[model samples]
Target: MRLRVQGLPTAAGVTRVLSLLAVVAAVGLLPWLSGRDPALTVLRARSAEQEPTKEALDAVRSDLGLDAGPLDLLGSWAADLLHGDLGTSWVSGTDVLPSVVSGLQVSLALMGAAFALALLLAAALVAPVLVRGRRSAGAFAAMLAAVPEFLLATVALLVCGVWLGWLPTSGWQGPAYMVLPALALGVPAGGLLGRLVADALPAVLDERWVELWRGAGVSRARISAAALKRVLPQLVPQFGMAAVGLTGGAVAVETVFAVPGIGRTALGAAKSQDLPLLQGAVLALLLLGLVMGAVAAFTRRRLLGPALRDASLALPAARPVRTHPAIPLTLLTVLAVAIGWGLLRDPYTVNTAARLAAPSFSHPLGTDGLGRDVIARLGHGAAPTVGTAAAVCALSLLVALILGFLPGVAAGAADIANALPPVIVGILVAAAAGPGTGGAALAVALISWPPLAAHAAALVQEVRASAFLTAQRAIGASPSWILTRHVLPSVAAPVARHALLRLPGIALALASLGFLGLGAQPPAPEWGLLLDESRAYVERAPWAALAPAVALALLAGLAVSGAAYAQGRRVPRTGGAGSTGSTGKKKEALVEV
Candidate 1:
């Protein structure tokens, strides 16, 4: 047997190193760019009563080495990072390394548990779809995947902790405390991974090898194993994405459960404007994400094995095909009705007498603790929440298309951006621009384009490889003509479909940040802001929380359904709507015929 080892290309290694440097540079430069006097903020954090006179602020800045220019400070910090020094916390006046290490330990444990749970859930969901060809199960998983981790964390806390009294509500006391947070992070991630697997499997099963295995009387178990092996490599990118999701989702999960993980630590540091601690936290999370991506890449290489040498092999890929319309159509109807009804109510008129009022003729969804109508807030919030999400999606699609057409430009930057989650980006944005809707939108847009870009890039490569494209090239057709007439039509529809599916996720990310006071401010009636406002009064008035929560749930359902319906409705001229080139739908169609 010939043994061969595959490693990341030299270019990729250089790209990664550059990406790391870029992140470190950004972290180092943040305090200087933020405009807020870091010295004053540190003084207040250390001693709130201390008068921030010029002398005091100057002393603190000199002591922290912030008296230098931004580039000089960044260089010094980078030098310290090379020598294993993480600097000192501005808040606690202690070494940042120790705090970061302790928090990293807790966050790593939570992330590991959550990722394991996600895999288990993915396996369970995929097993049924693979064995029984259950499309309904896949559809259900898609909807479940759209749910935000914060919402899951909140519901799990209420049902499993407060209501049933089964698990501890908060704190990092022991394993018991980990369950709720893990469930919150894992379920949605699992659903996403499973959806990808389910969509890819039908095509794999239809491969001639499966028939050959059956004809040779190979055991069902062996055949299934072989099929999974073929499908698994296609999931490497998604696995990395799932890893990012687990870490990013931890911010809200940790906050909701009061887990002393890095996410919460980072959040606290951001709020206090503790540049040292926040820098350490961001670095740690960024490194962890890249490491996970590397691990996934390594696993994919190992899985490919002989396939690496077999140039003629045609590996199966996932495709977006037709799906049943019932679920999506039903979800669309529900959202429309809810939004229309809530539009008629007043969201701003407050009445102290009706505070925490239950559902009645006057207020269908009841009133918040501040006596603002729940349904009205939810209805009014839809425009800002959904409109901003749509804008983010549109911007991401634009970026994806540009990057997709150009092969290598900004690829390293995309890697760096992918390492930072929307929430983490939000922390950075808030540090510089202060918290607001515009900053939140920019933060989300920064990290949201990588996946779509990957999709578009893959599509571009696929189309470029096709015989028709080659034939056109052989003829007198110009590159621009071939691209515009052939490539754009083929690439645009599928990428757009993928971007459409992301609307709910972008909205959720925005809401999660808003829930953490990093997005829309008060009186705006944004869905996430409303949820944040109501969380404190959840026990006193469940309706206030439930109204927005239910509304978010409905929104998730709508996105999933709408994406499915659109994908089902459109017929691609070349490859499938899915970024993956799997012919699962074609396989199913053959079976039906």
Candidate 2:
């Protein structure tokens, strides 16, 4: 049981044991986690492409040695890991590592192309923040931020690949096929980078050296470089996060773009319950993320060196002035009201004669294949989209507060919750409740709360450790009273901020679920479902897809923008509400594709 540095000790053994336990949870528990009998389910899986008779299932189980003990299975997997074998996929019956490598290469290439474009775009956008001001930069970021990668993918496919016949619409054809997917990924990450750089630039620009440089008639480009030098160290964490977020978000993007990547592979593995493939993909992604994070951390320290000793040398806020979410919140409200007005003003009145009409009079966004008013369906979708998001955020916040204060519950819940991704949770809900709007809301909340609770739990732990809480404890305050007055109030701002940040993610998860046929079914006008419906007519009626894609992306952007505005205003010198990059951390949804 001993572990580490060269044959370690008791404490290390405990840690190793815990690590083994996690491995057990991840691999040993997979069969039950799939909500099926492993032998039977694997035999009948979509990937299997055929149903197995009982005798066949038994024979296959015997061949695969599913009768082995959990520990034996673990040992087998350990042996496989030692040999770098991820096991063969049940579907293809080929070596999984090779496919995984191919997928990784695609994902990395896609993300690599994205990273380069992001840097250039970020530089261009941050330029204005240096020479001009944030107004133009902020406005532009908001505009681009409004679009999610999947919607971006659909649009690019509709316009460039399909309508114009300029690019291939499907497959990993070549570098030519990569452009739309890379651009889809790049634009949002670039917007994030620009926002981060802009946030870091203000104080650097305000400094006296900059004034001297300006007075001495230095080129704005050179001056901007100086500002960038000061900003670069602070950007490391955001950059790392952007990369991580992009990787995490790649599942939907890769699937939509028909790109063979780990994200898409993982989703397929999950659906088929391909335990080894799924585990390998998750482990690889987790390791990749860890490496990226380590690099970011090391680079941050190296670049920050002596500057780290000075808080004054850290990145500056977008505006030191108090920021209210009033404008963004107002915008959200106006959108809701407008959508409601549309719903009342004949958005849903269907006309067969107008079916598949292009954008023109009487139907602004044009008619879908169904002849349903495109604008009406989009407008109708807004209610469920916004309402479901609001409800889920509210529920998640409430759950986070309750579980976060209870140490036992928070610790146990976080472990279980983090293990299950939104898609898996949505599928379970879809199975239990059947596909519909109510189940969709529940699915969103079901997938949404775990991470939020984990955040709240950490915050609560920090608060409980503080001197003020200890002092209150010494005064003989009841745990409940202390939790309510101290813990609740202390955690509220962060919980609120976290909720705001998670909303768009939740929205996207809902959309992804709906895309997979687990949410509101077709003809329901749910934005995500609308995308599903529009896929068939995308070539002939591109606007069918275009309308929902635009609306949904904008909704995500506005939600995120609201969170960003709150973070800008609320993050203070005390650093109480987590990193300034809090919103950016969860902005994974937009770029995740």
Scored by lDDT, the top model is: 1
Report the backbone clash tally of model 1: 1
Per-residue CA lDDT of model 1 for 496-590, tens digit only, reads: 86787788889989999998889999989998888888878776787788777888898888777777666667553434322223342232212
Tell me how far the alpha carbon of residue 260 in candidate 1 is from the true structure, in angstroms, after superposition.
0.7
Q: Which ten contiguous residues of candidate 2 have the minimum total lDDT? A: 584-593
Shift of residue 474 alpha carbon in model 1, Å: 7.0
lDDT of each prediction vs. the true structure? 0.82, 0.68
Off by over 4 Å in 1: 1-16, 306-314, 317-323, 462-490, 572-593
- Residue-level lDDT of model 2, residues 1-593, one tens digit each, is 84447654444345434643664455544543445556765576534566677788887677666767566676777788778888877665678898888888888888899889888988888877877766467556655655666777778788788778887777897998888888888888888787667655776788889899989999988988878878897678668877776775566678777889887877677666676677677666656565676677688777768657445454443443223677677667866764764586555677788889998767777888768888777778876776787888899889877876665545444433444455544544443345667776785675467566666666666676666666778889899898667677767766676787677767777776776566777667788888978888888888888777766765675665665565555433342322313333332211211
Give the poorly placed runs of model 2, Cα more than 4 Å off.
1-24, 37-51, 69-75, 133-135, 207-223, 272-275, 306-314, 320-334, 337-384, 398-483, 516-525, 560-593
Question: Can you give the lDDT of residue 147 in candidate 1?
Answer: 90
Error of 2 at 510 (Å): 2.3
